[model samples]
Target chain A: MAHVISMLPVRNEAARWLRATLEQLSILTDRIVVFDDASADDTADFCKSYPKVRYYRGDIPWFEQNEAELRRHLWELATYENPEWILALDADELFEERATLELPWLLNQEDYDAVAFRIFDFWKGTEQVRIDGAWNPWNRFSPLLVRYDSTLSPDWMAQPIHCGRFPLSYRDRVTFYSHLRVQHFGWARGDEHLKKYLFYRERDLAVYGAVQSHTESVLSSSITLEPWIPMPSPGWFSEKEHR
Target chain B: MKKRIAILTSNHFEPSGARQVYGGAERYGVELTKLLLDMDCDVEWWQVGDNWNKEIIPGVPIRGVPETETPYQTMPHLNQVFFEQAVDADGAIYFVMYLAYPTVFPNSISISHGIYWDHPGMDKFLPSALDRQEWHRRLQLAIGGVRSVVSVDTATINWVRATWPILAQKFSYVPNFVDLNSFYPQNKESRSPHPRLRVVFPRRATTVRGINEAGKTALWLTESHTDLEFHFVGRAHDDNMERTLTTWASSHDRIFYYWLPPHLMAELYRFSDIVWIPTKSSEGTSLSCLEAMASGCAVITTAVGGLCDLIQDGYSGLLIEPTARALADATKRLASDPQLRERLGTHAREVAETFSLDRWHSRWSEVITRVF
Candidate 1:
């Protein structure tokens, strides 16, 4: 059994994003599998730059089968790696520098089979910019981090778009931490981001045969812990300025 | 002679800024769907999701492509199966451009919710680096197959006709009309206490809507005139607007900025003496202007785009050029003249009767019937 680790799935993305993902994960895991899902641009070539990166052409024959194939690919990776744990992410998702450095120690623990990390989704380049306030707390996505051999069952027809489906028995073995967060870099500048979004949105509609509303997908589903609370920019605004 | 009328939308009650899915569009759509149901016409509002509860609107049937939560990136994939579900509608209006929506259907009519000029230098003011040119190209290409173009204002119709002359032949003009009964003078809280000569600005806090210029004009009005109160409405939660207004408000006691619920907005108009709009960008006839006018408020709007059609300079209300000095002077003059305010307010309210809800419903119903 190979102790293989997979780096989620990706499509057309800039080389810089790929660089950030690789650099963040270099110290934590040795086995790196990169799934290339028919990128129109040079995303596949960019992934090949890293020596340890294992690239696979997405098995979906047409755009309609993209989602099924993507979900199945993750299952396949889990079965093949059979490692202690499996880390899943999109191309835009990045492991923060602090979390990346500390991941090895966290993974070595025996109590938690799947580890959950706090994710601070900064508006991509807002970290260096002074124009906007601190990152928005309302914009966060959470998914399960499980052991490689875990049997995961997903209910694809429900909420939490990507992570709507999870194994019922694996609930008690998972743990979430606040110190480490997945830095999702999906929202960048320009039409390139919109192009990717539009492409994925269209692909989703084609496969599913309808528009899945965000309100139902996020707010009304079983996955929602509570009603969406309007949280102010936690770190950006002072208590006085919050009102 | 029952007909199928479909209103294409991404979803209802979402935060999208499109007129159909947001604000008055949803109300208008609901009203239109109800009207069609009464007429025994088959009406369906289609989108990608299943958030729309069947019992939300009684009697009117709502259909969706599917309740899909797939992680596919493109929009066409979501509705590839649902596009087969389109009934032969007498008329169909694509409210906002979802990828491949217009192209998916066979024979139908599309109404222009708004036009994107794709102004080459629009990015100079807009913060987003998204290619306006490409957005415009795709928008124009998508609507190319529509049977005819229906624009709410002459400016949008003229711009599209002139920019793409080939498509001009199919242009139809239908001014935006408001429900007079829903927005007319109500026995709401008695008009705002005119403790001081009240000046209200109800536009978005963006450069596109000329909020900066309006702010500068407000500053000039307050500095030059002592007995005036300035009120700014709409999206006060915006960070940039908050920052700018906070600094300005500290020095000026009379200037107030805050957002009010839409229902309460009618009360703001009922009490205000004058409504000032100093917008620099494109505006499909503003519903706010019509509402203010119907509630008997003198409107001081710039002579740009649809505002020109609404305000007849010195007659209905002042039509000043889009400038800080010009708007400031106009406000000052309106502040001094109580008689002019009363006259303009009365005329403004009277003229608004033409665009009342009954009139608009009749006009829209006529379109649906013709197509059927």
Candidate 2:
């Protein structure tokens, strides 16, 4: 028997949405671990009511700091819980009926480390969702299930709004699974919340760029550029090495 | 017998509420004209910058008149040429708020967009350096001889009706409406992906119209409530405001800002838990506030201008007198109480359904049919 664990990274969320997420967690997953990146509201305390949920507290200095730390901690927690499969998620994302049942089966498949599920975005309200009824073109990917033994872990590139990486990092080592659906709740009228996320994103990019350049300059001066007196061009270096 | 209605505006699209677009009167002109067209009457649109006699709809004609050589001084004269051209028609619905042109015809109906009054600077919010005596004089001259008058709301009509009480008596409140079919609430999942308290503030960076206490309240809320995310939409008016906000946002990870398209803005209302727009002064009925309410967002706003008409305290949404403290307190109230947010959001959406496009078009059709 394979152990399954779900993880959600959340900041501040609407109450109804939070309640929905909790409901989904109770039914589908064995253990739900949520990393509260020092949320400003009762999100932390609220998650505490559920016994199956494990909440980790972390201080977020900036947007990037929060995302990076959350991913790292989620990996650590998932690894420690030692679930055979880790279903990574955000507070608003949920598994569709098909994916909820098929997720375990897909993860257990031989040589599969991570699985990407198709995310149906209910762009319109409850009425539209009912009318359009499952086949809308707007659905994308939701990466809630990942094998712990896989090489995939948290990295800097997996930071912003969409932290999932594609092209299935290991084409040869891992097998691809499809037809599974994960429902994404990102597009709801909560775009006002998105503005706040963008603000931090802009700042995060600026700081990340500045730090990257600063590090490159420091590294080049001490190691790469300083050692080469004349600092020969590419052609010269290639010629010398070949000769 | 179809009436040919002429609407004077700068653009066909009025995306946001308040004075951002064709100003209040110009938008009112557009709304009135659209209403007439919906009633199956022949309508024509006249914009300042558009080409003359462009076809907007088949029988419904639209025209644009470019400003004259000396833009500031010659616009009124150019508008006069257009006005003269329009005089031969059966009747004209003119949004002549500024001193663009004098509608000499007895049949012209002037809708008041704004007033220059004694100090034009007060209305324009210009620096003390520029002399606005001419602006004020020209505005007074424009209103001096109009036969029929219209205003967007009671406050604006009241301001004008003090001078022309007869016209004020003739004043009718024709509110703006959003097409619910085009702009409705998003599904529950997209609106609130996680259970984080979503606080949305959709105001431009203008000091007069924007959430003045956003920066302070955001910082305070971010520090106190980590689970709450604050979203500030619309563009900043200047470099100073942008820089100030950027600096303020540097302190917290939760504070997020985004520049979005109108469709995306509609989507935001779905996701946001609470939509906050606290304006100090100069507000007509806010399309943004109405849109948010329609899209199922619990709203907190100041009782300014037409917002009073839309936001009913303890029912649809919360209305507080404009202040940082009031804004913060209202936000805190919604943030702490999930039940209140859900209840208010549910009611707000129901109330928004009443102001649909069909209702707006019907009301406007009456004004147009009257011209016949």
Candidate 3:
């Protein structure tokens, strides 16, 4: 049996959708490593309530100011658990229900070092994902699940804004592009869209000297939306299937 | 100290005298400068011309950089030159979206009027598959380099998003607007009683504007309907096109060809019952269409570019394909039904309120405020 640990970098998300995220993550992993980035809300207490969650709060806010440093800290904390695999995710992201069934098979495999999944950006509500224009998130694969390797040192993109999740060296290793999807409800609410827009205007402009173009597109009214369709996990790791 | 802003464009003047190149893009540039001026920012306009400098308006100077054309397009050269010239400025604005290709300055924004390559004639511009591929590559670099983009229509935004989904966050849709006060409908009591139904084609005589189709449709409708009057109320690109239009108008009864200044166009729209904006390709949210809608004229426009954003198929105005036969059919239908015209005109005016100049100013000011 292999132990799988899920690491999450979260901020003031207690009042939003943090609990629902924790509830879903608890079902998939043996232990959940949560690094709260100086959240002002009851996120630390909420996360502490979970038996599987090992919660740690930063002394000062760092996610918006120094994302790479924060992610590096989260990575170090997750590695301390001696888990076979680490699943890096945001507080607003949730894996599909099929991921629970697929995770055991995925962990038992020795052919791949990492796994990538298509992400769906849910707009206005949880039932539908935005498919129009730049909202086509499913077209690109995000490497969220990676096998732990102690020999190779992880290098993060040292920018405060748009610093990617996972080590910069993750692409060098073989990665399986999994069919399982991640539902990102970060931009699901209308008010949250405005809040995010203003947040980027303040943080990105101050740090990067320019607000990212996608920040302006968050509030677009003329977007094409499609209902969320659940994809059945490929039974590659089942008893009947052989590599 | 006022924040200094430099704007790079292809053309604002006609490369010679102080005479401004009157077009939708030029109008947008002027309006954007005015807004920046109101925000107390020192603004300057740079364009490809024969090295001249003059003030287009009070407190705003327009300078011309020597024209340099490359095989790919003149855009990359213009962007590089503008970046060098505007280095001292606090920030920059790429007035034309394509001009930001290959590179752009930090703390800069770009403006996309609409999708200009949707026309069939784009083959002549790109010529080869390799040329188009290179063009697309440069365009992606241009868009990625800019901090933000202000798109006049959703058409260009959608195209960019579909082409490069990663760059979707860069665009903000801000459609063109009309001055409701200047372009209001005439009261029924004030309008002079006229027997003939007046139909106006108030657009520049250019191939992309669907002038040939409009001319054919106007001629057909005039010959068929005894009580219909067709008016061509815009300037031609050159003397040859003007001569062609004048000759066509001379041979037909109830047909008129004339040009009016921007201020006087309100009166022309007020008297007209139906407006035709049959643009074949390369369009944004047209100023002419918005003015017509604000003036309560039932607009019949082709579903090209941002025209779709302004006129819903049967709600505010009639939308059709850019063909002479389609234009003729829509015109004939409107000419026969006065009640339908009135209903569409009223709804158009109502829709025009949402795209008021005040709203446009507020939206644009918000975008510029973040950058500057």
Best by lDDT: 3
lDDT of 3 by residue, A192-243 (tens): 6777889888877877788766676777667888777654432212311321
Q: What residue pairs are clashing in model 3?
A: A213-B169, A213-B170, A214-B169, A214-B170
TM-score of each: 0.51, 0.50, 0.59
Candidates ranked by TM-score: 3, 1, 2
lDDT (10s digit) by residue, model 2, range B1-372? 765555554443221111123133333444565566656656666665434344333235555566534322224654576676666566665564553345444555656432223222364543333435554455555555554555545666767568555545555566657668756766665332354677877776566554567666777777777778787766454434554554455345666553343434565666677888786666767777878888888899877766777878999999987777777788889888978988888888898888787887776556555645
Question: In candidate 2, residue A124 scores what lDDT?
Answer: 27
lDDT of 1 at B206: 58
> Model 3, B23-134: lDDT tens per residue?
6777678788878888999998888778887655544777888765755653677677888888889889988778887667788899988888887877888899999998
Kindly indicate the candidate among 2 and 3 with the higher DockQ: 2
Give per-residue CA lDDT, model 1, range A1-243, as digits (tens).
224365556666655477777655554566667776777778877778877677776644322344544655555654565666667666666765544433554454333355554344433253521121223332322444666544455323322234322344444342322224466555444334455556657655755666455312322223212111111111111211222
Candidate 3 deviant stretches above 4 angstroms: A1-243, B68-70
**In candidate 2, which residue ranges exceed 4 Å CA deviation?**
A1-243, B1-4, B10-75, B85-90, B99-101, B112-148, B183-192, B236-252
- Model 1, runs deviating above 4 Å: A1-243, B1-5, B9-91, B96-104, B118-144, B163-166, B182-193, B236-252
Q: What's chain A's TM-score in each predicted model?
A: 0.65, 0.65, 0.90
Specify the poorest-scoring 10-residue window by lDDT in model 3 chain B: B13-22
